[model samples]
Target: MKKKDNVDLLLIEEMREEEPSWTDYDMDETSVKVQLTDTVFDMLLNDTISSLRRIETRLT
Candidate 1:
């Protein structure tokens, strides 16, 4: 399959929605400590690992 040079319009719109603004403040260490529960951390790690595996499979 051939790759397209240009990005899809839908993807551009989705990214525009997901992009963080300058006004967004960084979380404090204490806030992060409070929020990073084991279940949330585990889910985040699993999602990231799954995403990487999908990308690797596509590349190969």
Candidate 2:
């Protein structure tokens, strides 16, 4: 077994940040925003996997 850092818990907190807050908007604005949002979401997913892997490795 290995040690883990608790700070990963904070980094895992999506709601703690303001950028991801849900909002109501016009479709035209939303359409443009969606592209940028998708890229951000993809990056988040990539980061989440790495964070999870680090924690998982620490448990083994």
Candidate 3:
């Protein structure tokens, strides 16, 4: 795999590890909203990254 792919995998792994922390009930409403927003952003970013990789593969 390419270095970019490796970096992507690492980022994914990090995100997975942080997933459980978002479930903690001690956070305030604002914090929860921010975390949820970050989660949604990360999901969209990963989707975009996958799409770009697919396009790159098709072109090469």
Candidate 4:
């Protein structure tokens, strides 16, 4: 079989040899906690708003 352009044949063979663990298909029961202050929250909100506005202007 011919490999596609710039494709990694060795990596593909290695992956095919690997046996997938239960973690690959099963979801773990873990809780994540993030405590963001007002200042950090405002910065993230502003950045997201600006990115959306930029996209909207480009599309219009």
Tell me, by lDDT, which candidate is best.
3
Give stretches of model 2 more than 4 Å off: 1-30
Clashing pairs in 2: none
What TM-score do all the candidates reach, one by one?
A: 0.41, 0.46, 0.54, 0.40
User: What tens-digit string does per-residue lDDT give for candidate 1 at 1-60?
Assistant: 123424466677778887775335566655777677766989999999999999999999
Q: Please, what is the whole-model Cα lDDT of each candidate in the order they appear? A: 0.75, 0.78, 0.94, 0.67
Better structure of 1 and 2 per lDDT? 2
Candidate 3 lDDT over 1-60, as tens digits, reads: 699999999999999999989886766878989999999999999999999999999999
lDDT of 2 by residue, 1-60 (tens): 123455666566654574545554577698989999999999999999999999999999
Per-candidate count of clashing residue pairs (backbone under 3 Å): 0, 0, 0, 0
RMSD of 2: 26.0
Q: Which of candidates 2 and 4 is the stronger one according to TM-score?
A: 2
- Cα lDDT of candidate 4 equals 0.67
For each of the candidates, the C-alpha root-mean-square deviation to the true structure, in angstroms, is 22.3, 26.0, 23.7, 16.0
- Candidates by lDDT, descending order: 3, 2, 1, 4
Which residue pairs show backbone clashes in model 1? none
How close to the true structure is residue 35 of candidate 1, measured as C-alpha lDDT?
74
Stronger candidate by lDDT (2 vs 3): 3
State candidate 1's TM-score: 0.41
Q: Candidate 3: deviation at residue 59, Å?
A: 0.8
Point out the worst 10-residue segment of candidate 1 by lDDT.
1-10
